[model samples]
Target: MRIELEYNARSIPPADVARSFVPPTPHFGRLLSRNHTLLLGPRGSGKTTLLKMLTARALNSWTHPEAAALTPQVTFNAAFVAADIAWGKQIEAVGSFDFNASRKDAAFVLHTLRAIVHAMREATELAREGRLTPHAKHLAIEITESQEEKLVALVAPNLSVRPALPSLLGLELALEARLDTINSGEDVAPFTVESFPSKISLLISAFNGVTGDSDRRWALLFDELEIAPTRVKTFLLSGIRSFDERIIVKLALAPYMDDAGFERNPISPHPLHDYHTIQLSYPNKDDARNFGEELFARTFERIGVDAPSLDLLFQPPEGGSQLGRRGNQKRQGVPEEFVSLAQKDTSFAQYVTERNLLSPDYRFNENNIAQDIRKVLPIVVARNYYLRRFDGTHAVANRSRKSHGLYAGYPSIVEITEGNPRAILTCVGPMAQDYRQDIERADGFVQVSRSIQTKAIRRVELLLTSLLQVVPLDLGGFDAGKGLLGFVDTIGRAFEDRLLSRPFTTDYVSTFLIDENVSDAVVKAVGMALNAGAIIHVPYPDGGPDTLLRGLRGQRFRLSYALAARYRLLLTLGDRISLSTLLLVMRGVDVGDDQRALF
Candidate 1:
């Protein structure tokens, strides 16, 4: 029952590495025009995650039993086309982004492109591995001093043999040769900056030669392509235009004005076409809340019923010393302020994102301080809050200016996930890497000055509490028979828990990188809610971090979408919220144990 969730690193390799994932479902036709469509989005959006998911799906589709039975021809191969970006200080625009850093990293870009072609070819060949000769079915790259030389080796002799070209210019030559082979005698018109479609027809013909079909679909993934020059953009657009039916080129757009075309009319075609776009939006409160629930649900399913997820983090010894680990707590009553009905479950386990999360098991005995067992959830929350905060602080901390500019924003559930479920995992991921140097400078972060430790701890607290606070909240409503569900309190309680349970405000900015103003704003917002009686605090009878019961009578407008298993109202602070209160109106289940089955 070892429940281990392993993700393909290449698929969702941290967004920092290759942020070019676009979901491939609908966005078809116009958006998903090509199998190789470029995903365009602002920086920090989950492009990488989406890519990883796409790759994972591709990989799974190749091997998964159900997928294999249905879609037999789809191949799954993914690679990271990294941006060897040139840093620019004076740029303030997004649409017309120039990624060409003064520094030269085009070599890495060239290598990445070659790898993309080879990797896709390998995936295509995998469907008939033993049955066919590898080189005969898929094209393999021959690295030479010149890309033209390499192209000549792999391509037909008749294809225009342009040699020794630097960088992506090789791709341009290949396109020309491909068209020249098929349209040799045709009176071809010259490529114009604005008339891009004719160029696409030529490219399409080239692809038709390779796939031997006019409608063969191809997708080209471009990560961090904005660094290329405008002329290059026009040229590449033209090259791809020669093959619109055969390819969809996807690329990342730097989140600045330059990336957006300088005031293109809404109704008109974007100067950059062939890309079907899926824009990432800033997460709203509801979005954040739903995302948490989604994490929980996915994790639970992944954890399954066998291996206890909690044990993954903190397993007790075989001769367990702690008594009643499975049942209700001791005689000491749960706090009166906590929600009451959420007590005594099958286990002390939390399923998060396909992982039954628990603290990493330390020393068997409590005596070993180095191996002290701790709650995995709280620590995960704490670390997330810390790193997100840190991301904020490092982004704008201009120490040389004598003023570390306004720590403008704190993390809004800055969830740093590496497809793993513990602080130990994140300690090794992008979130923790930023601060690793500081920790290394002093053996460990804690060993550093108190100021650093405090700031780090504060961020960890903020993020942790934010995550723990909400679920698919009962956004108030009523059932066919049940009277009301206090949707507001349900949400309010969730939010309150997020704030109170995690670390409050702190002065240290460098640690979690929390914005001073944003941190304080959240605190003030929580306080204002409490002061207004808009958020009421209830006692938990069971002493759990989150009590389950909701109020009896509440705003009844929200019942339509609320699911039964999770929706319950606490009714009143004075009343003992329980299953009995729920049983009165809950129609699906009968009062007695021998209730009739629901259809």
Candidate 2:
């Protein structure tokens, strides 16, 4: 029962990953549409995997029954010329081409054209190799030949030696040779930027010919465009706008790329008017949970686990007796078993009483008692919850309090990972391995041990810490400075104070209410933090007004649980904090100070 799963999608080939891929429904629907799309998400949010899934190779390799069933309905019915390019690397490759610094913009356009041609060529090869359906193969050949003819006609005037039409190989060779000649300090006819749009139009026309007039059903799946040179990005965006109806240009971009100054490029058009955007990551609680369930189920099945559901893996032991009756109905309180277990330890008993676990009026008992226990026990038992143990004693503190320890459950783990496929796999893979080991060493339905919970929490904390560390570096371009980190810390402290004080807060906080009078600079910093996944935005109900706080009435923001746990803001998911109080705590603060304390 020792199961091993690949947590890193990059480590596996696209075909292989596609074999086990679980399609994210809404996101997948958007991806399959024939509209120009800009997919925005943080790193590890399955952008690469989604790109792979859209390719001809992945579609052809669909052996899984469920995924295969959907192929004919979407992927099989289309003439998709998918190209998985690491645009960052493409930018680097441009340096090798002979182009003056002043002509960088023109050079970028040429390089992009070359890339599009390369993608078409690669697609044709896949068809030639019989990876695509017979009809798709026929279309691929026609598309390839037509593209070569158009390309040669467009650039033939500048070429030292004109290549024949219908020979893509000759065109590629000639193009490369000419570039090499230019790189070696030889003079060549410069390509004009004015002709760029015409060349792109021809390429789009070739794609259109292959797909036919069937509702303009052709797609170019472009992955990792976030790292492309700014000029290259602008050129691509312009192409997208021009070919809006004829082709679907699907691009996977980092969140910050949206604000990467598209306006600065003369060729770029307004994104709001041109592209349909789909966020690859989950934006709310329900979406996260649904995704997590499917992901966990698939991974478990792959690893040979026979569990019915993900809940089984995290369920508490089952011997808790029902408490007294209330009005002929059960007066829900802590399970008698849990009460008995707590009684064995004086500090735990006090902790239970302080949290009102024995009271019928307690909210925890009204819900699933076992689930409530599972959530609270880990936080209470965390090593940091007590005073420092100089003598290495196991004694617990009399009162329940906030701890400088990472404590979380499966839900929080999913949230912290931010629906990143690799992060989720890696985070849960070890836990599954450990669980299998424990089962082998025990009897039927073994209880998840305290040590396992502790280890899992620590692992999640480490993962989140690694993710958070990248935010500042990534957002450095925004010049938000240390205030960005302070903003994050402010949210974390809010969670922490809630955990320590009475009457816990549960729902998301309003951004406007957090600090109504805060400067626009701080608000922008907060937005950067959101883009970085340091904070999450939970939109106001009905996309309408949020009237919770008086000063700021219609804005929304939610502290990310993963970040809160990483910073020891709160130990468990059940606790809530007051946003108004948190606002006061963060107000008038000089976040730029090097010595600014988080608490």
Candidate 3:
């Protein structure tokens, strides 16, 4: 059986969201509460999927240990207010009218009301079809003809076109036509658009009037608020407390500021005060690996196949002793690269001999080589392997035949993608698709060879680094997006020089700290990098505040692990350097009077 995985959750139909759903990390429970919540992470961080899974249609279709335990306690009626890219762009392009802000806001609020009405209709249909749980049956709401007319009159009294029929669907169409007139940029008289509070409070009052269930709870799950127009997005972010206590607002956005970078936009809500924040990406190595492995196992279980763990599925390169059986092989004294480099480079030989890895006679110290050297084998292997090919001038060495082995193994892959669900799946999805016949033949018993995993790692590397060209950014006078790739190359070369330095140092560069007083263009570039996941924030220890792109003055960040293989850097967070110093030292000599400097 060729198991197909749909990585994009938004593309999945609302009714089928549960069918494609993989149980989220433990953060799902926090969102089930009445408090407003924000799901923060870069794109492909499973934000949309988590929000969609909250709706009555998805909840009714979903069956899992976690869902079973949590759903019975869910009294609220959840509605998905999907603001996708196209719709968001349309909102941003609305014409300037007499009350431009008010009209644009009204358009957004009216669309939100339509989604809520649709949700209520869905719940009623589920109840009629006997698909809702006994407890969830009370969530069904029916809007009478009179109630629909009353809502249309209250919320959209100034629309040129009134509902042809007195029904919820007719009201939705009328609002749609009104929005179309606004977007058409025609001459229209100014109309009264209700404030968010007035509209929402009136809608809730109407709901209570119809259902007679005054104690009912409501959750508005807003997906992709990051792409929404600034006025609309900021209003939603800043006004979480203004809504009624019975209604909860859930928003999904990236960690960086809006497109208006570094202008002190009042968008970031206070965590635990305004809303409970749920992070979708794991930065800790151990946490990421555990989550990635379980996700792989559980995902395969859905197809009636017992998938092997990530460790069992990806065999490490033959050079390292870390993967157990490969270490105990009869032919191993140390990796072959060690012996080869010891003969050619006196520095590596002396360094290994001092550590008891090589003998006084310049041969293998077999007794000391097996267990004592296992701890440093990855660094040893990476440094020795790249040192041979690194020509002193360039930072990135030309790829040799065995260069891919440095990034192959389970540890490398998990760290490369930082256990992001979409990234992890991207690495393995290709291999699974390629080996579908083999998997079916063996009833899903399969192991991805090091070569195949290496290909996946390199593919991710190319895709990540290429983001500098693919993502267009406007940074006033700088064109920072174009300079970003060269900037990355300079950083990579600095780390490589450290790794291949004389006498072999383990303290190679891995992370970087941003200087507080850099040019605003540089700050904007770094912010864009963070938003693109090209650089990930390393948090402070012991519950210290991680202000990330907000307070970036002294924040530490590392290049995405996808570039680790490209530059021969290890998967571990090795050491930190000033990003400014690295750039100045690497390319400072090339600065001229006329040309613009990258730093």
Candidate 4:
């Protein structure tokens, strides 16, 4: 048997999305409320999936346990208007024909209105066919022919192009025809157009008139608003502050709003006041593991049988011989090399002695080591694996080496995926196939080996690095030879260098804070990196205010653990440093084409 999960929500049909939906904590319930929202996340952070699942079609199709009681709470009729690449192109092209800024904004709003009408039409058809859930059926608009004509007459009068008839299709056709004229770049005269708020109010009134649910609200779910025109984005931002009472505006955009009128900062809409902002960026360590484990278990549950616990499937690599080859010798609990390091390196020996794992004789009792080092076992394994002989001494460490069972197991996989659903699916999909094949050959569940897990993680790293390399970044004036990839690699290798440095100290530099006096081009690169998920913003861990980046200065960011394998860095946050120091080192080295993306 084989199980497959869709990585991209846009490609999934509306019904399928509801069927496979896993409600992201806090965001889903908050989104279901009547408050206006700005859902900010990077690409593939389940933004599209969440927005689409709010529609009537998906709500009716939902069979999840919470659907029974929760679906009815979605009182507003939702319209999923996708401001995707095609819509962006059409809206921007209107300006190519010398359309005024207001005209471009009007066109964007018109298209948005058309999409709402389309959603209503689809819901009405579903209700008429008896395919909608009871709550959704009541939410559907049942417009009579007379009411449709009245709607067109009231709404289409402000349009430069009027509808041929008084029906829904006619209104849509009129909008389409007008869009086509704009797209053609043909000469035309200036004409009257309705304001965005006015048009939206008219539609809501028309919807209420038909549905006979005057008290019910309407949600305009706009996906990918970052791709919309600048004027339109500004208009929408204003709408977030003040909009129609019956209209709920939910805008989806990237975390970095460099293009959305905040050239020096990310989009920072005041949370809880202007609009409720739901961040779907990389979660913290504990949250990531819990959510990722849900996805992991759900993947196995698709096989139609009781699944083993996640730990049973991808067991953590044990220390010593379990992690690496030890010839044909009897397996000891701890590595002999670790014992040797304690004998040779006084610092390492003293560090162990402090923990009581080492005796006064500078020898480790294998039995006592296991019981004593249980808490710091991972650190022990990492230090042993990465520590190397330099200048006839083991004081200084080597640059990271091949995996002695690093970046494996469930916890590591969760960290690598960084709470992104698309990333989780991409990493687990191949392993699930392997699990299926393994079960068919054997009777019981087979543990996915560390090599397999490492391979999956490495594949994701390559794909991400390759994407950053190909996508052009507007560095403005800063020339770093290799564009975004070079910027990311320079930081990544620097972190790796820190991880492997010193007298075996655990407190190494991993995260970085952007210096206040850096060039604008560097700040732009950081913004682009945040937008692309190459680096993630690290909020203060002590429940401080979740503020957006006004500028990169003093803001802390860590490279995505998705690139951790490529640099052999740990799957944890460490001490921070100024980014300027790292850039200074990069500037000192003559980085050329050969030095691009060291992975």
Question: CA lDDT of each candidate?
Answer: 0.30, 0.51, 0.64, 0.68
Residue pair clashes in candidate 3 = none
lDDT of 4 by residue, 52-154 (tens): 9888889888887777767777878888887754346454555435556555555576677777877777766676677767655655656676766776777
Give the best candidate by lDDT: 4
Regarding lDDT, does 2 or 4 come out ahead?
Answer: 4
For residue 8, give model 3's deviation from the true position in Å.
2.2
The regions of model 3 sitting more than 4 angstroms off are 1-4, 73-75, 84-103, 133-161, 184-194, 258-269, 298-306, 320-345, 353-375, 389-402, 439-446, 473-484, 501-503, 542-546, 588-598
Candidate 2 off by > 4 Å: 1-13, 73-111, 131-166, 169-195, 206-217, 229-240, 257-274, 304-307, 315-416, 439-450, 470-487, 501-528, 541-555, 567-599
Give the per-residue lDDT of model 1 (tens digit) for 260-310.
232224543333353334533211223233333233233434444221232
What TM-score goes with each of the models? 0.35, 0.67, 0.81, 0.84
lDDT of 3 by residue, 402-500 (tens): 366766666666677776667766766665555454566676466766777777887677666676666655544334656566556567767766666
Clashes of 2: 2
Q: Residues 432-542, candidate 2, lDDT per residue (tens digit)?
A: 677777778887787445456556656655554555545553332223454456456656655544333222122322223334444444455555655556555444456
Q: Which stretches in model 1 have alpha-carbon errors above 4 Å?
A: 1-45, 52-81, 86-116, 127-204, 225-243, 254-259, 270-276, 280-282, 285-599
Q: Among these predicted structures, which one has the highest TM-score? A: 4
As a TM-score, model 2 comes out at 0.67
Q: Tell me which of candidates 1 and 4 scores higher on lDDT.
A: 4
